[model samples]
Target: MVDADQTFVIVGGGLAGARAAETLRAEGFSGRVILIGDERDHPYERPPLSKGYLTGKAERESVFVHEPAWYARSDIELHLGQPVTAVDRSRKTVTLGDGTTIQYDKLLLATGAEPRRLEIPGTELAGVHHLRRLAHADRLQGVLAALGRDNGHLVIAGAGWIGLEVAAAARGYGAEVTVVEPAPTPLHQVVGPELGQVFTDLHARHGVRFHFGARLTGITGQDGMVLAARTDDGEEHPAHAVLAAVGAAPRTALAESAGLALVDREHGGGIAVDASLRTSDPDVYAAGDVAAALHPLFRTRLRVEHWANALNGGPAAARAMLGREVSYDRVPYFFSDQYDLGLEYSGWAPPGSYDQVVLRGDVARREFIAFWLKDRRVLAGMNANVWDVTDTVQALIRSGEPVDPEALADPGTPLDTVLPRA
Candidate 1:
């Protein structure tokens, strides 16, 4: 049971930490809440950093989860730019970078994740970058603006969502862009080949070039600035700037050092937690990217690095901390925007788990909904340029009822009507 006088310490002041603190207050927990972050800025949303903020379509101030004043008003202690160096579970306290030891009865680890840095040579060059924080996006934005229209070539190292989004934004700035991926198609691992081809075609139509089944061996530089990228295939791609969008790994050092159990590295390394988001230690909880929790719907452990998971998981963890009967059971969901294409995906179905993909609407025209099915049961679904059907898509996955492919493909059939009756 949580005592009202005990301090609740939250590490990692990102969206997850902010939301957790908000949940604590809303749940009537009058305990002292301290939110610690290594970054100097207030908690902010990262999705915009790759899209609107990088393209100059959104302001920097707008990305913050809440204004600085809100923390003070909420009576939540904000410890920005302070890294927690050690977690002493025995002492029930954490030591900060500044040598301050803070005691906590309940602790939440929301350490989030970091962008995977490239090990290739010339990564130290001035024009080489990676987008994970506001500062990185700001630097890339400046580099793009300086390049002007077709004045420079931007070579992207990976063809994942971040790579594709940055490619669209760079092209919008009139910079020639090229994307290289080890896979055969962009997002092939996530959305599968057919749907991935849709994105590949979309970028190709917008003047973005792609090099599939390729690996960036090293970066070549001229006078401390990146000039080109050398791939394993003996091709040198001209690059005025290079953005490494390879992917990210969860920040699990703190949790690991504290002796908390983590998921296997092969299955996405992060602190292991139950359905209620409680860690190996009942006094400690975890949420957001740092948590690999059991998903009741999937009947497996899943860790999502998307914005929606952080937005919902934090609150659920907080409620559980207060001894409320809660389970973080929402279907995993995420959305991305590139050029004119808008995408929303719900549920999880690993590659090869789904035997067939059912397509509704047009794929070539860049407007459609696609569902991944296993044994004629919906496992996951995604919509491109399609609006207001996410709820129905999620319901289908939750219902776990076998659905007919023909009804799903028919435009006249409303999505809600396709579900099995309760």
Candidate 2:
């Protein structure tokens, strides 16, 4: 028995909020639903922004999650290009940027995230770029094309996922890429040095230069346009364009003002929530990048900034809001595409969390599965150009069973064969 008079309001029009709204209708909730977004564009998946869309492989309309009429037909109250400036939790209301206030029976925050702006000098230059929004990607696509057509050099700051993907896209347009990172390898904080070198070599072989063990100190420019990227090592990499692919920070201003508990910066900061995605306020919930959720398997708070989290988390939060039994313990998953190599990674194994990494198949051939193990217990697994096996790998981690490294590394031994018997 659901309350037909209730009104549910979702802040943030990203994939998570859209999916949650869809789930509400699908789950037989006939109540009123209102969705607000700061950006005018409809909800869309972000993967293509860095992958296909940036490279001109995907069309502008392909990234959207729904056809335009779907929201109207579904009876969802849609508000676009309006930032929710304040939240009155005690009054059960939210104030938009233009001073419009709306009341809600239940509130969901999926405010998502924004790119971490570069604090270095010359960031205000015309040719410097950051790629977190649709508008940014659109502008960057033209920049890459012009650079490639002119045989210009592009310097990228940071070697994170965004950086590497943009580098690959830029290379496809025939532009020279120089990636500046402070770590010894690309994605050092993520896949760690062992797997980082794989990406390093991948881009290096494709004519992309690497300036590892260095940071972009500043940008040099003539007039209002960028000329080159200056590294902390006292070296300047010539460039017609500079892209700061540092990272993103979760948008949590509304949550903070509402007095919601938040995770610390060092712990991947976001609104702190329990297993059920319930924030400090019972009527207020959060999901996607903004929710620092308590993961049961990992026994730690995780704020995953991947598309899968938003894809799955939204529906889970919706179910919880409906008073249905829910324990969101899905295995963390994400994938990446760079040039000819495609990789799918499952589970968590940040650096220092795993003691050993075992490989199955040939690493040199770019076809293999890398397993991170802690005391023989598999913590995470990544398959590079190796298809399938995600279910098996995730199951092994969920089983919490220690496996023999020899059999885990054997290509002939099927991954599931090593799992504990039912």
Candidate 3:
């Protein structure tokens, strides 16, 4: 049981950290709670950074997870803009960038992740960018507004969710855009080739050019500003601005320094945690993108970078830290918005794990639900422009029962009917 007077220090002031603090209070832990973060701003949702916020559809205040006043009212201390340089597990302390040390009885590492920086030459140029924080989004928005409609060309270096969403936003602002991907298809690893084609076709219809199976060798610049990006095949794509959306790597430096065991690199390199979100060190725990927690459903330790994981994992970790019986076993879920299409995906199945994909609606109309099955068992499901079926899909995945493909693919059959009877 948690001692009533013990102090709980939470590292990383992202959604996970904020939620964990909230959970502590809700659980009646009146102990001192402190949240530290490197960013100057309070915790905020990141998905809108590429979509609504970048496109000017959402305001800056709307993205915040909580207002500054909320922390004060909740009795949680905020240590913004101070990076934690090291964690001294032996002393039960964390040293900040300014050399300030904070002691704690228990700690939560929710350091989240950082964008994988491009190491190619000319990355330091003025027009080259990476979208990870709100500042990056603000800079990109300024660039878009200055260019006017259809006047500027944007070259996106990766075709992942961030790249594609930025492409859609750029197109919305009337900027000519081209996406270059080293893979054969966009989002090939996540949605696979068949469904990936749907996105390629959608972007093509909106006049967004694509160069697949190409590697970016260097970015050519003029007056220290990006002018074009050249591929390994020696083809140069002209651009007013370039965005490298390759992917993000979990922030694990502090955890490593503190001697926390990380998952094998093949499992996506993160602080290894059990179902309760406790690290190998009993006094330390991890959550959000930094924790590779064992999933009861998948029967494997998986590190998910989606918003849902952070949202749910935070409270679960907090409860576990309080010595409460809790398990972070929610099915992984994420969503993306590009152009006019909104996509919701639930469950996890590595690429090539599922033998077949069964579709329930029209792909051409962009309204459908697709299910990936392995030996008739639903492994994952995605809905594009189709609403009110995610819970049903997640239920089917949780049940782990065999589902009939004919009924799964039939548009006439409701999704609820596909599940096993109570």
Q: Count the clashes in each prediction.
A: 0, 0, 1
In the range 106-171, model 3's lDDT, one tens digit per residue, is: 999999999998888889899998998888998999887655564988999999999999999988
Global fold similarity of model 3 (TM-score): 0.98
Give per-model CA RMSD: 1.6, 1.4, 1.7
Instruction: Kindly give the stretch of ten consecutive residues in candidate 3 with the minimal lDDT sum.
Output: 141-150
Q: Highest lDDT, which number?
A: 2
What's the TM-score of each model vs. the native? Answer: 0.98, 0.98, 0.98
- Backbone clashes, candidate 1: 0
Clashing pairs in 3: 150-174
Which pairs of residues collide in candidate 1? Answer: none
Compared with the true structure, model 1 gives a TM-score of 0.98
Model 3 global lDDT (CA atoms, 0 to 1): 0.92
Off by over 4 Å in 3: 1-4
Local accuracy of candidate 2 as per-residue lDDT tens digits, 189-256: 88888888899889999999999889888998998988988988899999999999898999998899
Who is ahead in TM-score, 2 or 3? 2
TM-score of candidate 2 against the unseen true structure: 0.98
* Span of ten consecutive residues with least summed lDDT in model 2: 1-10
